[model samples]
Target chain A: MAAQTGESASTVLVCGEVRTCLLPTTQALDRRGAAQLLRLRADMYVRVSERPIMHVLSPETLTGVDCRLPASDGSRTRAVGTVIGRAALTEGRLLQTTSYFGLPAVGPDTRRPWGQYLVRPGIVEPFGMLPRKATAAGVLQGARRGELDTGTIAEGLAAQLCRHELLDRRAPFASAPTRLRWVALRTGGDRPAALTNFTLAEDGLRTVKLRLPPDVPASAAAGLCEDLALHDWLLTHVQRMLDDHPFDRADDSRSLAALRPAVTHLLHLWMPRAHVDGALAHLWDTLEAAPGFTRQWQNLVQRIRDQLTLLDLAQCRRAASSKGCEE
Target chain B: MPERVFRESTAEPRTRAVPLAHLSLELGHLYMEDFQLGPKRLGEHFAEVRIWADAVRARAARRVKRPRISTCFLIDDYFTRFSTPDEVIPTVLEEAGRAGLTIDYLARESGCAVADGVALAESVAHRLVESPPPGSYGFRPPASRTGWLTNGSRSPASPPRTDRGRTDWEPPVETAARNHSIFMDVELWSDDKNGQRVWSCSFLAAVWQLARLGLLRHLGEPVLVPREQDVAALPPDWDRLPPLIKVSATKAAFSAYRTCTLVPHHFLPVENAVRLVLDQVDVDTAALAQVAKRSADEGMPVPPEVAQRATYVFYEEPGDPIEDGKH
Candidate 1:
C-alpha cells in the first residue's frame, strides 16, 4: 500500500499538522452516528475501536500538491506529490484531523507521471537534492505564500467534516481548536523512536519533533503525534475552562457549568498511546516523564471533583438551616 | 512488547481479495452509434481489435510462464439508452465470434457510475486529488469541487492585485513540461437540464480502468464482481443486468494486473482525459497492495502506477455503412 512508501529507507523526512476540536453537535455521536459522519468514502469502512475508548477513524484521503518547499533559508525548491489526510472522532466528541507527507532527499530532475506519485500517496518528491534542515525548520515555522502548508489541508478536512449534515454545527460548550505541527526526521540503526522536542508556541500552535527509526512508518509516527496532540488539547482546554470561571464568582453555578463539560466529555479521554503502534508507543514516555501529560490531567480531574463536592456540601447545609428556621 | 488478549473485529479492517488475470485485454467499446450501424460495423470493429488483442496476449505470455488473460467489452448505456441487453448482447457476441475473438466479460458503461447500489463514480471523484501547479501553497480550490481536471496551471482569471499592470492573457503552462507545454483541461462531469449530475465519458473510462486493475472496493469488499449468468436467458432491460457478466466459460478472471484497450483513434482525447483522472485518483491502498502482493507472488509484479498498468491501441474507426430503408 502507499502508506508503506513512507516506511521505505528513501524517505528522509515526514511532517504533518493536526487540528483538534470538539465535535460541534449538541450531543456526542454514538458509534453508529460517528460511522455515518466519518464515512468519507462510501466503499471504505470507518474503522471503529472499542477497547480503551470508542474511536472511529476515517479512511485516508490524498491531496495532490506541486509547489515550492518551505525553506527557512529561503531556497526555492519545487516539489510534486500528494499529501495524505484522515479524520478521527474519539468518543464521538473530540474531532481530530491530520494532514501529512513524507519526502525523499532527492528525486528525478523532472516530475514523473502523476500515476507514479499517486502510488506513493504521502510522498512529496523534490525536483533535486533536499535541503533537510531548512525544510524541517520552515515547516515548523509554517509555509509562506506559494509554499506547501500542511495546516491548511488539516483544517480543510476538519471543516469539511464539521459541515456534514449529521452535525448541527452547535457545540455543547465553547472551546478553542488546537493546532499541532510536527516533523519526524529519519534515523538509522535499531534506536527506538524518540521525542526530541515539544514546544507550545503562541496562538494555539504546538510544534513537535521526533527522531524516528527507519522501520517506523511516517504514518505510525503521525499516529503517535496525534495521540499527543489530542491529550495536549484536552489538558489545555480543560485548564482554560477552570481559569475562565474564577472562584470569586458570586454564583457557583458558573464554575459548575464550565467544569461539567470537561467531566462529561473529556475526563476519560486521557488514555495516551492507546491507539499508537507498539513500536513507537514508547515515545510517549519522554513527555510523560517531563511535563507529565497524565499527571496534569489527573490534577485537573481532582480539582473538578473537589469543586463539585464542595458545592454539594454547601447546598446540604443551606437546606438543613432553612428546615430548622421553619420549625 | 508484551502481548495480552483483547480483540475487536470492527477495528481491524480487512480487504477482500479478488481473483486476478495476468492481462485483461479489452476487445472494443460499443456505443449507440456503433450499434446503430448494424452487425457488419460491429464485426469490422472486432476484426481490428483482434489484431491488437492477440499481440497483447503474446506479450503477457512472454512475461509469465502461464498467463491468465481475459477479454471484455464495454457497452455505452449511460449516454444513450439503446436496445435491451438481450437484444444487444447476442449481436455483440456474434460479431466478436465472427472475428474469432471471445469476450470473457461484458460491462455496461453505466456500471462505472454506479454498481450494485454503490456510487462508484462519485466515490472515485472524491478520491481525485488534483495535481497542484507551482506556487499552489494548498490555497487553490480542489479540482473535485470545480468539476474539472487539468494537466497544468490554468491562466489567471485576469491577473490578481500582484499583477495589476498585466492586462494580456497568459498561456496556461503544463507543470511537467520540458521547455514546452501540452496543457489539457477536461470537464469530468456537468449538470443536466434537470440538475442531475452527468458523469463524463472520460471519468467513467477512468473508473472502468480502475475496476480492470482490481483496485476498487465497497466497504472492504470487492466491487464490480462479474456474475456468471445464463447468457441465453439474459434480461431484456439494461437495468436488470448486472454491472459485469461473465460471457464466456473461460478460466481467466474478470480483472487483471494490467489492461490493454483496443479503441479507435477518435477516443484518443477521452482516453487521455481518462489517464489524467487515473493519475490523480488515490485508489484503495489495501486493494492496491493485494494486487501488488499477488502479482509479486506470481513473479509478474504489476506497474506501481495505476495509469501505467493500462495500455491502449488507438486504431482507426470502423467504416459506417450507408443508411438502408430497412430500419
Candidate 2:
C-alpha cells in the first residue's frame, strides 16, 4: 500500500482490501497528486498485460525470490529478499498508521481475496497496506509500555476512534488546595470542637474556620450543611452521655458503650425526677391531643428512661467508692 | 229591625268619586261612612264576590277527592283575537279532543281507570295559583345608588338630570305592564303573609292563574312585553328561549346582582374557589399523563411514587447534540 501510494510509509489495509498509506503531512499526497497517480497506475496495468492473470499473493511474495534467475545476477538473487525487506521497513518507518475496528478500506487499484483477515504477533513483510488490527494493537502496546505519550496515542486513533474510553477512567488521585472557607459558629467557649486560639470581640461569638477541598464545588455546600446537621445531632447525644458520669472519663472515640455515661448525665440534667414526671404528663397529653407528637414522644421517653437507668447505676458506683475510701 | 231599616232607607249615597284636589277629604268621609254603614254594605260590595268565589271552589273541591291531580290548558284567547273565531276555536277544540284521547290511551296502557277531567282541571288550576310558576317571584333589585350617582356625576349635564334614585325605573310602557302583572298576580294567588297581602307568584303561574280565573278575558292576553330598551340590549338568541328558561333567567339575574353587589366583598374567595376547582381538574389530568410519560421514558413499569407525583406527561424535545455533550 505504501509503494502504491508512491510514498514509503506504514499503511493500514482495512478489511484486507483497500490500502490506506499513512504518511506525515509533509510527505502525504495532495488530492490532485493522488488522482494523477491513480490514472498513471491504470494506464500502466492495461498496457503491460495481454492476457488476464490473477495471483493471490501476500506482500511477502514480492520479496525472497527472483524468478528470472539466469537473466539476473546470482548475487542479486541472494540479496532480493533482504533488499525488499529493507525497502519495506524504511517505508513503514516513514509513514504513520491508523486503526479502524470495523471499517472497510477503499482506494484505487486495490484487490481483496477474502475481505476479512486477522493479525498475528510477528513482523510480517509489508503488504500493499498495513492490517488494521495489527496497527491498533501496536499503538496500544506502545502506550502501555510508555513508549508513546497520550498525545501520540490520541493522534494515531483520532480518525477512527472515540476518546471517551481514555478519558472516563479514574485519573491518578492527588489532593488539590481548598477553595472554600467553612466556619462553625458556636455560642459558647467550652464546645468540644472549639478553636480557641483566636480572640473574640465583646459580643462573645466564636467561629472555627475550616477549608473545603477545591474538588468540592460550591454547589455541594448545601449537601455539607445537611451532613453537618446529622453530625450535630450525633455529637450532642455523645456529649450528653459523657456529662452524666463524672468519674468516667472517655475520649473522642464514638462507641455506643462509651457514650452511655454522657447520655445518662445529660438526661439527669435535662430531666430530674420531678422533670421526668412533668415530661411524662406532657407526653401523654401531647400524644392524646396531637397525633403528630406520638411517635417522637415515644422515642424520646424511651431514650430518657434508658439514660436514667445508666445514671442510677453510675451514682451507685460513686456512692460505693466513697464508702470504700472512708474505710 | 224592619222598621229601623225603613227609617234609614232614605239615607244619601255614602260613596262617591272625588276630584284629585279633594282626595284627602273624600277618603276621610268614606272611612267614617263605611264604619257606620255596617255589614250590609260590606256584604253587598266586597264580601259578596269573595263568598261567591268560595262557593264555586267548595263545590269543585267536593266533587274531586283524588290524591293528586294535574291539568294542562292551552287557552286560545290570543288565537281567537288574531285569527278568525271559527278557525281558532275549532283548532283548539280539536287539540283538546286529541289530548283527551291521548290521556285515555295512557290510562289504558298503565291499567288505570279514567277520572273526572273537569275535577282534575279545577284542582290543578287551584294548585297552579297556590304555587306560582318558576321565574315568577324573583325581581332584580334596583341597580346600586353608587353606580347611578357615579354615572350621573360622570356624564355632562346637557339633558335634564335624571333622578339618581330612579336609575332603575322603567319607562311608562314597561312600568305599566309590570304593575298590571303584579296586580293580577296578587288577585290570583291572594297570598297573605301575616295577614298582609303580597303577590309572590312566578310570572308564568300568574299567566296560568289569570287564564283559569277568566281574568284574561277581561284584561286581554298578558304578553310579557319586555321593555323595548331591554329587548334591544338582550344577547343574541334571546328570542329563542331554552327549555330551562326558569334556571337561565334566575342565573342571569343572580349573576347581574352578584356583579353589582357581591363582587367587591366576595370576589377573591369566589375567584379562589373557581381556581381551586380548575386546578384540581388539571392536576388529575396532568398526573395521569405524567404516569404514562414516566412509564415510556424509564422503559420500566411505572412505580406508585411516580404516578403520585407526576403532574404531566410531555414529549421530550429532540436531544440537542451540543446539550448532550455538555451533560
Candidate 3:
C-alpha cells in the first residue's frame, strides 16, 4: 500500500473510489483515435464495475469515439456503441470489448484486435508491472538447464525473491567458497569470479596470478609438482588403456590387478624413496588388514614369485646354451 | 625361614669347558686318520692349511669377545674344501658357540697330528678356566730334510740357539703364512670350475647345509654380475681379480660348474692372468681401505653406487618362445 515516487512524479494521496476510478489517459492515447476512445471507456467501465461498486463514469469517455463504414452497401448503416459496463469491467471483459470496438464490423464473427485495451487503475499506474510469477519460475527452470540469462540481471532479482524461506541466508552458495579455494590451490591462481568466468573465455586459458601461503616449503612445492605430473601421466595411461580395451566387459578385480604395477610405478615416480617405501608398507598393511585387496594382493604376490623363478630358470638355460656353443 | 644364601663363586662358570669328544665324533665322520693331523700339519695334507688355521684363530677371538665361554671345532675336510676365505672364517665363527669349547687362541704347531692337536686344544681349553693361554694350539713338522722322527733323541748334536731365540718347539710364523697362501690357491682352483655341474651341485649342497644349520641367514643374497666392467673397480678383496675375473668367476662357478668343465687353456689367456693378479693385489688393498674408511666416516652415508654396480645380469637375451607366445 506504500507508494514510491518516481522522477518528475508529483506526490498524490489516492484512496478508495478516487484511486479506483482515476485511470491514466496516456495508456488509451497509445492506440488509434477511435480505439483510444473505446479503450478509455472500457478502462472507466472496468474501474466502476465492481460487485458493490460506487463510482460514475465521466463524460470525457465519449470524446474520442468514431465510426467506420461497412463494406456491404453504402446505403446500409450500422450503429456501433462503445459502452462502459461495470459487469464487463469487473471480469476483465472490457479488454475484449475495446478490442471489438477497433474492428470494422460489430458482429459475432469478427476477430478482436490484441492490445486494444488499457489496464486500470486509470490515475495510478498499476502497482509496478510485476514479472509474472510464472515468469520467475521459468527463469529458475532455465537456469537449472544450464541456460544462463545474459540480458537481464535475473540472478539478483531471483536472490531478492528467494530471500525469505527458500534460500539459506547464511550461505546461499556455500559450495562456491570451497570450489574457488580448490581452483586457487590447484591452479596456483586467484579465485575466479564465478563458474561463468570459465565459460566467458573462448579458450578457457585465462591465468590469474595467486599468492601462495608464506610458509610453504620449497621441497613440498617440488613434491606436489612431481605428484601432479605423475598423477596426470597415470590418468592418461588409464584413459588410453580404457580406450584400447573393452573396459566395461573386463572384471573389476582383474582390471585392478592389472593396474597395480602402473599405479606402483606412478607412486614411485611421485614420492621420494623413503616416502615410497613407507607408502608401500602402508599399502601392504592396509591390504592385509582389509579384506578388499585380498584377491588382487595374492595374485600379484604369486605373479612376482613366479616371475622370479622363471627368470632364474631362463638364466640357467642361457648359461647351458652358451657353454654348449663354447664346446 | 632362614635367609637364602646367594653365593658369588670366584671361579669361572663350568659351562666354559669345550666338549672336545663331541667335536671329535663329528670330525671322525668327515676325514681319515691321516687327515686328523694338527692345524700345523694340516698344510701337508691340504693345499691351503694356513687360511683355515687363521680362520679358526679369528673365530676363537670373536667367541672370546662374547661374555660366554665357547669352543669351536672345524672338520678338516670341510675346512680344506671351502671356495673362498670369506666363506671359511665367518661360518666357523657362527657355529663356534654350539660347540662346548671356549675358543681362546687358534695356534698351528708343527709335528703334532690332528688327534694330538685336538687333545692339546682340549687341555688348553681346560686351562683357560684357570686363566690359561688364549692363542690357538697346533703342531709343526720338524725342519729336517727327513720326515718326522719316531725316536725323541736324534744322533746329531743340537745347533747353537740364536740370540733372538725362537725355539723349534713353537710353530713358526713363516709356516703359517705359507700354509695360508696354499689354502688360497686351493680355493681359487675350486672356484675355477664354477660354471660346471659339480660346482653348482656343491654350491647348492653347501647352501642347503648352511640353511639347515641356520647359518645361511648370514650369507645374504648373492650378488649378480653381468659384465666384466661392472666389477672393474671392485673392493680391495675383489680388486685382486682381473677386469674379466668376476665375469669368468661367475660363469665358471655358477653356470659352467653345472653344465661343463672348462680347462685353464680353454678360458684363461696369459694376458688375462697377469692382469688379474696385478688387479687383485691393488683391488684388495683398496677394498680394505674403503671398508675401514666406511666405518670411520659414519656421518657421511656411503652411496650404494658401488654395491649396485657390483650386481650383474647373467642372461639378458631375447624373449623365450614361451614369453613370445604369451604376448
Best by DockQ: 1
Per-residue lDDT of candidate 3, residues B24-127 (tens digit): 00110112333333332222222222234334445434633421211212222222432322332333323332232222212111101112212211111111
Q: Model 2: residues >4 Å from true position, as ranges?
A: A1-227, A240-327, B1-275, B280-327
For model 1, chain A alone compared with the true chain A gives a TM-score of 0.97
Docking class of 3: incorrect
After superposition, candidate 1 runs with Cα above 4 Å error: B159-166, B320-327
Q: Tens digits of per-residue lDDT for model 1 on A76-131? A: 99998888888999999999999999999998888788888888888899989999
Q: Which stretches of candidate 3 lie over 4 Å from their true place?
A: A1-233, A240-327, B1-69, B79-327
lDDT of residue A25 for candidate 3: 21
Positional deviation of residue B11's Cα in model 1 after best superposition, in angstroms: 1.6
Predicted candidate 2 versus true structure: per-residue lDDT over B1-327, tens digit per residue: 123222121111111111110000000001223323543442232222233333433443463342111122122121112333233223332433432311000010000000111122122122120111111111111221111101001222344436774334332111112233321111212335676422212222222222211112111111111111221232333122211111111111100000000111222332322221111111111222333343345343332221121111111222222232574
User: Which candidate gets the maximum TM-score versus the true structure?
Assistant: 1
Separate DockQ for every predicted complex: 0.66, 0.00, 0.00
Candidate 2 chain B: 10-residue stretch with minimal lDDT: B20-29
Displacement of the residue B204 alpha carbon in candidate 1, Å: 1.1
